[model samples]
Target: MKTKFNTSKFLAIVFIAGAITLSSCSNDDEDNNVVPELEVKTVEDLDGSQGPVFFSLSTGTAVQESATTWDIKFNSSNFSFGNGAEGQVIEGIFENYVVAPASGYSADDLAGIGSLYTYTGQAASGAQHAVLPTPGRILVVKTHDNKYAKIELISYYVGNPDTNSEAFINLETRPQSRVYTFNYVVQPDGSTNLK
Candidate 1:
């Protein structure tokens, strides 16, 4: 006896298989497009003027400068990276940055963080003599562990006081300096994708 090919059953099986394959492909596409969340933090009252404060981008915490795990150190707006760490500065809106550059990172140099802010003098005509974060300056760091991070310096005051406010304009009432309020994103997979 010859076996019959059940056309309806064969079509059903083919349709189901195709659906499963498409579902899997769709899931993979979603995963590939997923972006890591951004981490925002403020290192308040660090008083980098008194000493250098170490920070770890990988852990999103301030580590002791002497600790070998630290990735960068902050000293009065002067940022220096740890061993084998490097960084680059780019001019653009922080939210627009997706992928960090793979090269052109300065090693243990001030070239990256040097242009982060502008200090207006007491004798300046208009705005208060405060250390203001440059409008579009962003820092991208290749961490000591070889991971990637993007930093946006938001404020240099304790509470991130409004620079235009009269309170901040007054020297006596000016928010304490050297307090870093910034947003950053670190790529945990050690890839250049900083989004």
Candidate 2:
């Protein structure tokens, strides 16, 4: 017995296969363009007297200052990049920034000295002398390993209290200082494409 070829059935199968292939290709493209979820972490009560609190953006955790894998450090209110690492504070909202710049990253000399926040002196902050995070300040950093990460300085006080509220304005009710809360994204691919 010989089997007969059905043209209509064969055409239908080919069309279906083509549609499935096109759908898969479209999904692949979408996946490539999708942005990764941002990582939010906080370093609590960094005391300069006790030394700096080192952090690793790649691992999204605080590391030992002496650890070779650390990427950045926080001493009191000051922060600095690890060896071979550099970064700058860009003026913009964190969510608005998409890609990291190609150049102009700094390691030390002036890494975290008033780069992300400003001091609300006795007369400046309405009887509340505190350090406040500057509005629209975003920190973009290049890890010591050459990977890129962008940071958003959230709060200098513990619990991330509302800075504008009366509770935050009152020095007695305000949260403790030296707490660093921020959101960051690390491009593990070592490319400037932060998306």
The top-ranked prediction according to lDDT is 1
Q: Count the backbone clashes (under 3 Å) in each candidate.
A: 0, 0
Q: Which stretches of candidate 1 lie above 4 Å from their native place?
A: 1-49, 111-114, 122-126
TM-score of 1: 0.81
Rate residue 126 of model 1 by lDDT.
48
Candidate 1 local lDDT, 68-165, one digit each (tens):
77887877877888978888788888888888998999875573234988887674564566888888889899989999888888888788888888
The pairs that clash in candidate 1 are none
User: What local lDDT score does residue 109 receive in model 2, on the 0 to 100 scale?
Assistant: 45
lDDT of each: 0.80, 0.77
* lDDT (tens digit, per residue) of candidate 2 on 94-188: 77787899999877645454678778677554536777778888888999889988887777777878778898888888877777777788888
Provide the lDDT at 117 for model 2.
77
Q: CA lDDT of 29 in candidate 2?
A: 100
Determine the backbone clash count of candidate 2: 0
